[model samples]
Target: MDLKLQKFLESTDFIRAVKVTVAAATPVILFSYLNLFSIGFTVALGALFTFSSDIPGNLRHRVNGMLASNLIATGSTVVISLATINPWIFYPVLISLVFFLSMIAVYGQRATLVSFSGLLAMSLSFSHSYTGWALLQHAGLMISGGLFYLCISMIFYYIRPYRYAELRMAECIVLTSKYLKLRGTLWDIRADRNKITEELLSLQIELNETHEKLRETLIKNRTKGGSSNQNRRLLIAHIELVEILELAMATSFDHNKLHHTFQEHPYVLNAYKHLAYNLAALLNELGQSIENRKKYTGKHRPFQDLEAFRKAIDRYEKQTHTSGRPTADEVLVLINMFNYVEKQAEKIKVVEYTFTHALHTQEPKHKDKELEKLLTPVHYNPITITQNLSFSSTIFRHSLRLTLTVLAGFLIGNILPIQNTYWILLTIVVIMRPGYGLTKQRSVHRTIGTLAGGIIAFGIISVVHNSTVLGILAMTCMVLGFSFIQRNYSIGATFITLYVIFVYGMLTPDIQDVILFRIADTLIGTALAFTANHFLWPSWEFLSLPTFLENSIKATRDYIREISVFYNRKGEVPLPYRIARKHAFIEIGNLMASFQRMTQEPKSRQKQLGQYYALVVLNHTLLTSAASMGSFIQSRKTTKASEAFNAITGAIINNLENAMELLKEEKQNIPVDKETKEMLKLRFTELKEIRKKEILESGGTQNENFRLKMEEGQLIIEHLIGLTNLSENIVKAVKDIRERQ
Candidate 1:
C-alpha cells in the first residue's frame, strides 16, 4: 500500500467518519419514507449545516458559532419570505441578508456559514414558485431532517463513549512522543527554518485538536460510571504529558547551541531517548487501561508502576549529582526536568486514585479544586469580545462586497446580451469573497472543481437517463463525493463543483452550454471577490499580527510572574495559575501565527520588523526557561530543598517584578541588590559545574564536556545580557514614545 493509504488505515479516524456518515444518512433515509422531496432538501441542508460546525478553533466557540449561524440562516429565510412582496424590495432584502450572513459565515461562525448561506439561497429559489403554506411545510421538513440527524449522532455518541476517548488519547500520546523524538533530531535536520516552523506549527495544531477531542469525550462521560471516570483521568494525564512534551521540545530548541554536547553525552542523550520511549509506553498503557477498565475491576496497576517510574526518575537525578560536579544552572535544569516528569507521574497517580474511588462508589466524589487546577481555560475574553468582533465584522464587509460584485456581474451579463442572468448571479455568489488571498485560492479551486464536476455530471447523465433509480444513484455519488471533498480543500472543491454541475444537468435535461457558462461565471465571481477584498476598507494582516504579538508577550511576562509566585509560596496557586499557563501557551501560539502572517506582508515597516524578531526570540527564551523552572518545582522530593527552592523563587519574583516594571516604564532602573545578584550568579555557576561533571562521568569526550560547560556558562551570560538589554531598551523606547507624545 502507498504511504497515504497506510496512514489512513492506521488513523482509524475513518471509523468515526463512518459513524458520522451513517448518522447523517439516517435522517435522510427515514425522511425519504415520509417524503422524497423533503429528504432531498433536508440532506442538502444537513450537508450545508455540517459546514457550520467544521471550524478549526475552540469547541465552545464552534458550538456557539453554529447556534448563531443557524439562527441567522433559518430566521432570515422565514423573515424575508414573510416581510416583503415586490421583487425589487425582496431582491435587496435577499442581498442584504446574504451580505450579513456571508460576513458571519466567513469570519465569525465558519462552521455554520454554508447552512446560513444555503438557507438564503433555498428561500430565494423556492419562495417564488411555492406559496406561504408550502414554504412553511418545506421549512418544517428541513428542520425535522436536521433534528433527526442530530438525534442519531447523540445516540452513537452515548453507545461507545469510551471508545472515542480512548482512541483520541492513544493518538495524542503517539503524536506527542513523535514530536518529542523530532525535537531531539531538529538540530540535526538541517531543514529550512520555514519548513521546521511549519512542522512545529502542525504538531501544535494536532496536539490541540487531540486535546479538543479528548475534552469532548470527557465532558460526555462526566456522569458515566467507573470506566468512564478512569478514562477521563487517563485523558487528563495524557494532556499534562503532552504539555510537558511540548515544553521539552521548546527547551531543546532554545538550547540548540548545546546540540553537539547533548548528542555526544551518553547519559544526556540516553535520558532524552528514555524519556521519549517511556512516554510512548505510558501512552500505550493508558490506552490499554481504558480498554480493559471494564474487564479488570481492580485498582489500576499502572499507577503503581507509574510511582515506581517516578522513583526511578528521582534516582536518575541523584545519580547525575553523584556522578559529576554539575554547575548550579545545570543542576537547576536537571532538577526542573526531573520535577516536570514527576508532576506528570503524580497527575497520573491522582487520576488513578479518582478512578479507583469512582469504580467502588455509587456517587463519584467531586474533585473540583484538583481538576480545576489541572485544566487550563480556553475561552475568549469578554473585554476583548468587541475588539475581536473585527473577525465577524469582516464577514459583514465581505458579504456586501460579494453582493455588489454579483450585481455588477448580473448587469454586465445582461448588457453583454447573455441568455442566463441567473448563471452570472450563481457564479458571483459562489466566487465572491472579502479578500484577495481567499478569492484567489477559491477561484483556482472552484474552476478546477467545476471543470471536473461538469465532465462527470455530463457522463452520468449520458450513462443513466430517464430512470429514477439512476437519478438516486447519481445523487448518492454526489453526496459521497462532497463528503470526500470535505476532507481536503483542493480535491473537495473539485468534486463539489462537479457534483453541482451534474445535479443541474439532471434537473434540466438538455442544456448544451451550461457547463461553459458556469466556468465563465466562476471566473467573474472570483474577479469580483478579489476586487472587493483588496479595495473595500482592506484590513491588512500586518496590523493585527503585531498587536497580537505584543499582547502575547505581555501575557507571557504575567505567566512567568504568576508561576514564580506560586513556587515561592509552595502551595497550590489559584485558578489563575492554570489560567495564566493556558493563556501563555495560547499567546505563544498566537505569536507564532503572527510571525507567520508578518512574513506574508510587505516588509517596509523596519521598526516593526526589529520588534517582531526581538519579541520572537524573547518569547522562545521565556518558554524554555519557564518549562525548566516548572519541571524543577514539580520534581523536588525533599521538603527542605523545596523550601530553599521556594525562597530562591521568591527572590527571582522580586527581581522579575522590578525588571518588568522597569521595562514597561522605560525607567533607568536600580539593578538587583548585590546580595541577590551574587546568589543568582553562585547558583547558576554551581549548576553549570554539576552538569559538566555529569557529562564527563557519562563518558562524554573532552570536547563534548567542554562544550556542555560552555553552553551552561553561556546561558548565564545570556540571561544577564538579556536582562540588561531589555531594561535599557524598554527605558529608551518608553521614554522616546512618551517624549514624542
Candidate 2:
C-alpha cells in the first residue's frame, strides 16, 4: 500500500468520520429521491457537520448550539418569509440573516446549533424567491427532512446498541491496560512527561465520550426491560471499575514522580509488571463479557492471589540484592504501584460479585435492594430531572445570551436604513453569543475564515460563471474539504465561509458588494454575542472550582477509610469506596473544565494556572496515598489475629470518618496533634504485638487452621495501619492547603 493509504488506514478517526458521513448522507439521499424536496444541499451540509455527543469536550457545546440554531432557523424562516417582498430586498436580507445566524452558531453551545442555522439560512434564502403557497410547501418539506434525519439517527442507535456498548467497554479496557503498562515502564525508568500527559489526556477524552454513549444506551435500554436492566447494571459497574482504575493510575503517576530515583529498583519493576499483566488480563476478560452480553462467570474459578505474586517477586529481589532503604522515588513508586494493584483487585471482585448475584437471582423487585447497594457505591445514579436541569441550565444561559445579542444586531440593522436591513437584524440575532469572552475568541477565527473563504468563492465564480456543472462540483469539493478540516476551528471556518459564499454568490452575481455587507453583518453579530456573554449571565470559574477540589479531597479520604476498614474487618467493604472514586474522577473533571473556562477570563491567567497546578498536585498526592495503602494492606497477614486487628481497624475507620467530616467542614486544621498521633501509634503497636503472640502460640500446633488465622490477622493489622497512615496524611494535606488559601 502507498504511504497515504497506509496512513489513512492507520487513522481510526478517519474511519469514524467516513462512517458518520455515510450514515448521515444516506438518509438525505433516500429522502431526496422520494420527492421530499431538494435535500441535496442539506445532505452535503449535514455530512460536513461532525459534532456528536459521543465526542468528549464537545458534547455540551454541540447540543446547546443545535438548540439555539434550531430556534433561530425556525423563527427566522417563519418571520423572514412572511415579511420580505422583492428579491432585491430579500437577497440582502437573507444573506444578512444567515451571517448573524452563523455568529450565534459559532458562539453558542454546540455545532448542532450551526447545523440549525445552516438549515434556517438555506430555507429563508431559497424561500425568498417562492410565492406564498410555495413558501409553505418548502417549510413543510424542510421540517419533514429534519424529522426523518432524527428518526434515522435514533433507529441506528437502537439497532447497534450492543456494538456501541462493546466498543465503549473495549476502549475502557484498552485505557486501563495502557495505564498499567505506563506505570510499569515508569517504575523501570523516568518516563517522558509530555508523552505521559498526552496519554492521560487522551484517556480522559475517550472515557468522557464513552460515558456519554453509555448513558444514551442505558436510556434506550430502559424500555426493553429484564435483560436490558441486567446489561445496564453491568455497564454501570464497568464504568465504575474504569473510574477506580483511573484513580489507581493517577496514584501510579504520583509514585513515579515522587520516586524517580528508584525507577530502576528490580523488585519494584517486577511487582509492577506482574500487577500490570494481571490487571490487563482482568480488563480483557471483562471486555469480552460485555461484548458477548453474558454474565462474567470466570470469577467462579480460583482467584489469582496477587499478594502471593508480590511476595514471590519481593523475595527474589531481596535474595539478589543487599537490603537497603529505597530512595524516596523508589519507595513512592513501589507503594503507589501496590496500592493500584490492590484497588484493581477490589474493583474486579465487586464487579464479579454483582454479576454473580444477577445470574442466580430470579425475582426482579427482590433484587432491587441488593442492586441498589452495589450500584450506590459505584456512583451509578439513573438520570434524573435535576441532573438534566443542571446540564441544560449551562447551555440555556449561553444560548439566551446569544439570542439577546442577535436581537441587538437586528435592532442595529433596522437603524441603518438599508433596504432589507431587517435581514441584518435577523443575522445579528443568529450570530451573537451569551458572553463577551467566547465572542472575542470566536470572532477572531470567524473573521479570518470568512475573509479567506470569500476570496476563494469570488475566484470560483469568476472562473466558472456559466458552468453550473462546474459550480456544483466546486460546492461538492468544498463540502468534503470542510468536513475534513472541521476538527480545526480555523480550517472549518475558512471552508464554511467559502462554501456559504459560493452558495449565496451563485444566486446573485450583480450584488458582489453584498460580500462586504455580509462581513459587516457578521461583525455586528460577533460584537453582540461577545457583549452579551461578558455582561450578562457571566459565570465565574471560582464559583465551582473550590467546591470541586474540596469534594475530590473528601472522596479520596473516603476511599482510604473504606479500604482500611475492609482490610481490618475481613469483611466486604461496602460500595462507598467505588462511589468515592467515581465522585473524585467527576470532581477532577469538573475542576479541569472550570479552570479551562477561567483561563479565558481577563485577569484570570495567574489564578487559573496556579489553582490548576495545585489541584493537579493534590490529585497526585491522593492517588499515591491510596496506592500505598493498598500495598500495605496486601502485604500483611490477617486471619489468625483477626479480632485484635478488627478492633484497631474500627478505631482507624472512626478517626478517618471524623477527619473526613472536618475536611468537608473546611476545618481540617483541627489538628491530629501529638496526642492523637501517639494514641494511634500505640494502638497499632498493640495490635502488632497481639498478632505476634498469636503466631508464637500457633507455632507448636501443626494445625493448619490456627496458622492460617494468625496469618490472616497479621495481614489485617498491617493493612489497617497502612490505611490509617494514608488517611491521616491526606487529611493533613487537605488541611494545610485549605489554610494556605
Candidate 3:
C-alpha cells in the first residue's frame, strides 16, 4: 500500500500496459507454438517495434498505419540482413537509410513511427552469414509477427472502437472537475493565488490537448459513418464539457473583496468551498459514468449545498453596509456568480442524462455549429523532405542527433565484448529523445529500472528451469514493460530489463551470462546517448525562446484578425476563424510548455527565467480574453450604428504586433491610439442602448441568448481592458530583462 506504488496501480496506463503486454506476446506465443522458436527472437522484436506505431486513431487509419509499418520493418530487416557481410558496402548504406528515415520523422507522429520502427528493424536485423533467400524467410517471419499484432489491435477495435476516446474524454471531465474544485479555493483569500493560477494554466493545457484528441475521434468516426447515435451522444457530451470550462473561466470574481474581509466572513469562504466540493463530486461521478458507458448514477445530489451557499451570500450582502468595503454592484456580482456555478454544476447531470435518455428539443442553429466543426478533419500539410532536411529546424536537429547516436551505438555494440549486443542498441533507441533534459531524466530512470528488473529476472530464472513457463513470464514482462514505458519510464525499464533476461534465458540457459552482459550493454548505450544529446546540435529552451515567442505572437495576431473578420460579417463563425483559434491556443500552450522546461534547467541556462514568467502569464491572459470575445460575438448585435467600432479591433491587432517585436527585445515604432480605449467605451455605451431597444422590440423580455450576450459582452470589454494593461506590462518586463542581461 505504498503511496507511489498504489498510484501506479491506479493509473490508466497500467491497464494499457496489460493490453500491450498481451499484444506484444501474441507473436512470440504463436511462433513458439508453431515450432519456430529460433526466429521468435527476430519476430518478437519486429512485433515489439511495430508497437511503436500502435498509436490512437480510427479503425481504418490504425489498421492501415500498422500494415505500412509491417511492410517497412520487413523490407528494412531483409536489407540489413543481406548487407551485414560486406560492411564497406552495407555500413554506409545502413547509416544513410537511418538518417533519411530519421529525417522523414519531421512530418508528424505517424511519420515518426514509420521511420523509427524501420530504424529499429534495420539495427536489430544484422547477421553475419545468410543466403539471400534465407534472409528473406527470416524477414518474412518478422513481418508475419508484426501482422499478428495488427490482428490483436483490430480485435480490440471491433470489441469497442470508441473505448480509447471515451477514456480520454472521461479523463478530461475528471480533470475539469478537479480544476473547478481548485478554483473554488479562490474565495478563500488564504489560498496561494499564484500557485492556483499555475495549476489552472496546467489544467488549461490538458484540456486543450483533450480537445484535439476528441476532435480527431469525432472526425474519424464521422468519416466512417457508423453508429451515429453513440457518436452524436459523445459529441454532445464533449460540447457540454466545453461550455463547462467556458463558464468556469467566465467568473469575474473580485479577488480583492476577500483580501481584506476573508477573515471577517467565514460564511463566504465556507459557502464557496462547499459549492466547489459539490461540483467536484458531481463531475467525478459524470467521469465515471462516461468511463463505464452506463447509466449515470447522478451521485452528487444536485443543489445539496445550494441553500447554504445562498444563505451565506445573502448574509454577506446584508453586512455589506457594516464593512462599507464592497459596493452594491460587487455583491450582485457574487450573487450572479453563484447563479453560474449553480447552472454549471447542474449541467453535469443534464449532460450525462443526454447520453442515455435521448432528448429532442429545439436549439439555436449555432448551438451545434461547434460540433459540426469538430467533426470535420483538420487540414494539415505534412513536412516535405526538403523542409525536414533544413538544418535550422528542431526536427532536423533531432533527426541528426538520433542518426549519430544510433550509428555510434551500432558500432560500439558490435565491437563490445557482449553476446547480446542488440540490447545495447535497443536501450539507446528507447531512452534518447529530442530534448537534453528529457533524455537525461529518461537515462536515469532506465538505469534504475534495468538494475531492478535484472534482479527480478535473475530470481525468476534461478527458480524456474522449464523454458515454456519462463518464456511466458518473459512475454508477460514485455507487455508490462512496454505499457509503463511512456507512463513511468523507470518501471517500464525494469520490466523491459526482465523481459530481455528471461527472453534470452528461454533461448539459451546461461542466465548469469545474459544478465551481466545485458546490464553492461545498457550502461554503455545510455552513456553514449547522454553524451551525444549534449554535444550534437544541442537546442535548449532558453536559446530558442525568442523564436517560439515570436511564433506565438504571430498566431495570436492571426486569431485576433479572424475574430475581427467574424465581427464584420458572420455565418455560423467561419471555419478558418475556428482553425485560427485552435492554432492560437496550441502555440501558446507550446510556449508555456517550453518555458516550463526552461525552468527545470540549470540557472545559468535559464537567465531570462523571470521575464519568461511575466511573458507566459500575459500570453495566457491574452488567450482567455480572446476566448471571451468569441463567446460573445456569436450572439452580439452589431449594426451600422457602430460599424466604426471595428477599427478598435485593428488598433488591438496593432498592439499585438508591437508586443511581438517588443518580446524579441527588438526596437520598433508602432503608433498606438491613446483614445482607443475611450472610443471603445463610448461606442459600447451607444451599442448598449441599441441592444436593449432591439431586445424590447423583439420580445420585450430577456431571452437566454440576450442574457448571454449581455454577460459575455461585458466580459469581453473588461478582458480587452485587461489585455491593454497586460500588453504594457509585457513591454516593461521585456525591457527590464534585457537591461539585466
Candidate 4:
C-alpha cells in the first residue's frame, strides 16, 4: 500500500468526516420516534446548513465561528421569509441582503462564509410560503434544529480539545521530514536546484501556515494561572520539533563549497547524505508515532559516521597541506559542513528523547515558563467592516455585482419551467466570485461537477426506489462532499450536486426531468455568473500583480533591516523583527499564489507575466537564504564580521530598493553603482583576511565561536551573492518588460 494513501486514510479530517456523516443521519434516523415524520426533513436541512460552516480551527474559535453562523441563519431565515410575503418588498430586501452580505466578504474568508451561508438559507427559505405566526414558527423550528447541531459541536469541542492542533503538528513534522529528503536529493551534482527550490518554497509556505495554526492553538489551551496545562507535553514536544527542523532544514550551507569539496573527495559527504536520509526516516516515523500517541518503532544508527566524517575531512586537510598551501577558510568549510550534519544528528536525538519522555512522564518536571510570550490565536474581528466601507472598495463592487446577477437569476428562475427555482439561486451564490479568474474557474468546475453528479443521481434514482436507501446514499454523499470541500473543490462539488439532486428526487420523482432541469439551471447560473464577472468591476489577478510585487519588495526591505538589527544588537531578537519576518513570508506567499492564479487565467491577460515570474522566483530564492540565516544570526555574538556586514548590507539594500522603485515606475536600464560593487568586493576581502589570520594560527579545538564565525561569514557571503543576483534580475525583469512594451 502507498504510504501517502495510508496517511490520508488516517487523517483527522477523515475521522471527523465519518463522524459528521453519522451525525447528519442520526437526526433523520431518529425521526421515527414521533408520529410526525416530515419534521425530520426540516431537521436534516438545519443540520446540513450548520455543517457547511464546520471549518477546522482551535476548539473555541471553531465553536464561535459556528455559533455566529447559526445566529445569522436564524435571523436571516425569519427575516427573509417574512419579507418574501410581498413581492414588491421581497425583491428589494433580498437584493439588499445579498449586496450587504457580499460586501462583508472583505472581512476575510470565514466572515465571507458566515455571510454567504445566511444568503443561501434565505434564498432556500423563499421557496416556501409562510406568514405572521406561521413564519415565526418556521424560523423558531429552524433555530431549534440548528441548536441540535450546536450540541454536537459542543461535544466535539470537549471530546478532543487539542486534536486539530496536534494533527497539524504531526503534519508539520511529516512535511519537514519529507523536505529533508528533498534537500538530500540536492546533494547530488545532477539535481535540478530550480525544481527542488520550487517544491521547497511550496512546502515552506505550508509550514508557515501550520506554524501560524500552532501559535493560535497554543494560546487557547494555555491556562491563566500556574496550573498544569492539558497541552504542555505536546507543546514542549512541538517546540523541540521546531528547533530540530531549524537545525535540519533551515541551517544555511554553502552549496558551492559542498559541491567543490565533494568533487575533490566524495567520501567526506557520503556519511552526511546517509545521515540526512536516516533523519528523514526517523522524523517521519516520529510523526506517525505522534499522531497515534505511540512510541517510535523505527530504528536507525544516527551519527554513526560523525567520527568517520571528521576523520575524512581531517585527512583531506593534511593532504591539502602536503600537496599545496591549505587555506584556513577551505579547511573550515569542510569542518563546518561536517559539524552541520553532526549537529543535525544531535538535534534528532534531542527530539527523540523529548518525544520518548515528554509524552510519557507522569508529571512534567519543568513547565513552559515562556508560554506567556506565545502569540495569541488570530480570530476574526468585525473591525475590517469599518475600515474599508466605501464604493471604491473591491468588496462593495463584488457585493453590487453579486446582487445584480442574483436578481437576474431569480427573475429568470421564476419565468422558466423549473421545479426547484431555488437551485438556480444556490448555483449562482456558489459559483460566482469577486474576481474573474476565480469565478471563471469555478464556473467551469461547477458545470462539470453538476453534469457528472446529475447523471449519477439519475442512475441511482432510476434503480433505488426505497426512500430509506436513497436517504442513506444522499446523507453519505453529503458528508463526503463537505469533507472534500476544503481538500478538493471539484470532487466536493460533484458529491454536493448528487446530494442536492437526491434530496429533491425524493419529492419530485421524475428522474429524467429532474436531471434535465438541473443541467439547465446550472448552465443558466454559470452563464450569468461569468457574464457578471466579466462586465462588473471585474478584478483580474494580472492587474493586481504589480501591487503584490511592490508589497513583496517592501517586505524584503524590512526583513533585511531586521537582519541588520539582529546582527547589530546581538541579543534576544526584537518582536518587531519577528513580525517583519512574518509579513515578508506572508507577502511572498501572496505573490506566489497570485502568480499561480495568473497562470490559470487566459493568456492574453498575462502580459509580462514571465518576466514578473522570474522576479518572483528570484525574490523567493533570496528569502529562502534569508530564512536559513534568521535564527542563526540571533545566536551569534557580535564580532568583527558585524562591521563588514553593516558596511556591505546598505549598498545591497539601496540597489534592491532602487530596482523596486524602477519596477513600480515601469522603467528600465537601472545601472549598478561601481562603488557599491567595489565596496561589496572589498568588504568580503577584508572578512577573508580577518578569517584567514584567525584560522591559520588557531589550534584544532578552539572556542566554538571561532567555528561559528567561519560558518556565519560564509553564510553572509552566500546571501550577498544571492542578493546581488536577484537585485540585478529584479531590475532586468522590468527592463525585459520595457523591451516588450
TM-scores, one per candidate? 0.70, 0.64, 0.86, 0.88
As for lDDT, the candidate ahead, 1 or 4, is 4
- Tens-place lDDT per residue, model 3, 224-327, is 55436666667667767876776676454567665565567777767767777787777877786676655676656557677677888778766876676644
**Per-residue C-alpha lDDT of model 2 across residues 278-341, encoded as one tens digit per residue:** 6666666666565445666563221355675467545544643455543323332344345556
How far out, in Å, is residue 183 in model 4? 1.8
Please give the ranking of all candidate structures by lDDT, highest first, separated by commas. Answer: 4, 3, 1, 2
lDDT of 4 at 418: 74
* Pairs with backbone N, CA or C atoms under 3 Å apart (clashes), candidate 4: none
Worst 10 residues of 3 by lDDT: 635-644
**Per-candidate alpha-carbon RMSD to the true structure:** 7.9, 8.7, 4.8, 3.8
Q: Which should have the higher TM-score, number 3 or number 4?
A: 4
Cα deviation of 278 in candidate 1 (Å)? 6.6
Clash count of each predicted structure? 31, 46, 1, 0
Q: Report the number of the highest-lDDT candidate.
A: 4
Residues 1-741 of candidate 1: C-alpha lDDT, one tens digit per residue: 664564443333444344345545555556566767445555546434543343433334444554444445455556566545566686677666655555445333353354445544433443244358876765665455445444544465457545555556656656665665455455443646555545665566567656655654454344233334456565555556545654564354344544443343435534544554555455445444443333324333444544554555455446656778454445445444454455554554453344345544332446533443434444435443344345445554555566666557656776875655555565556555544445556667767776776676667667666645544654555555545644655566665566556555655756447766766666665666566666765555554554555566566567666755665556654557656665666666666665655564445522355555555555555555665444444443212223334444455445445544543435544454788657765765565565566555665333544444444344433443343344335434433433433
* Candidate 3 stretches greater than 4 Å from native: 1-34, 127-129, 258-273, 292-295, 301-328, 346-349, 359-383, 558-580, 629-648, 663-717, 735-741
The global C-alpha lDDT for each of the candidates, from Candidate 1 onward, is 0.52, 0.52, 0.70, 0.72
Model 3: how far residue 344 lies from native, Å: 2.7
Off by over 4 Å in 2: 1-139, 154-163, 166-170, 192-202, 205-209, 218-247, 250-400, 415-444, 466-486, 510-518, 535-537, 554-580, 599-605, 623-741
Clashes of 3: 1
Q: Per-residue lDDT of 579-646 in model 4, one digit per residue for the tens?
A: 67767777787788778778777788787787877888877766666655665565445464456777
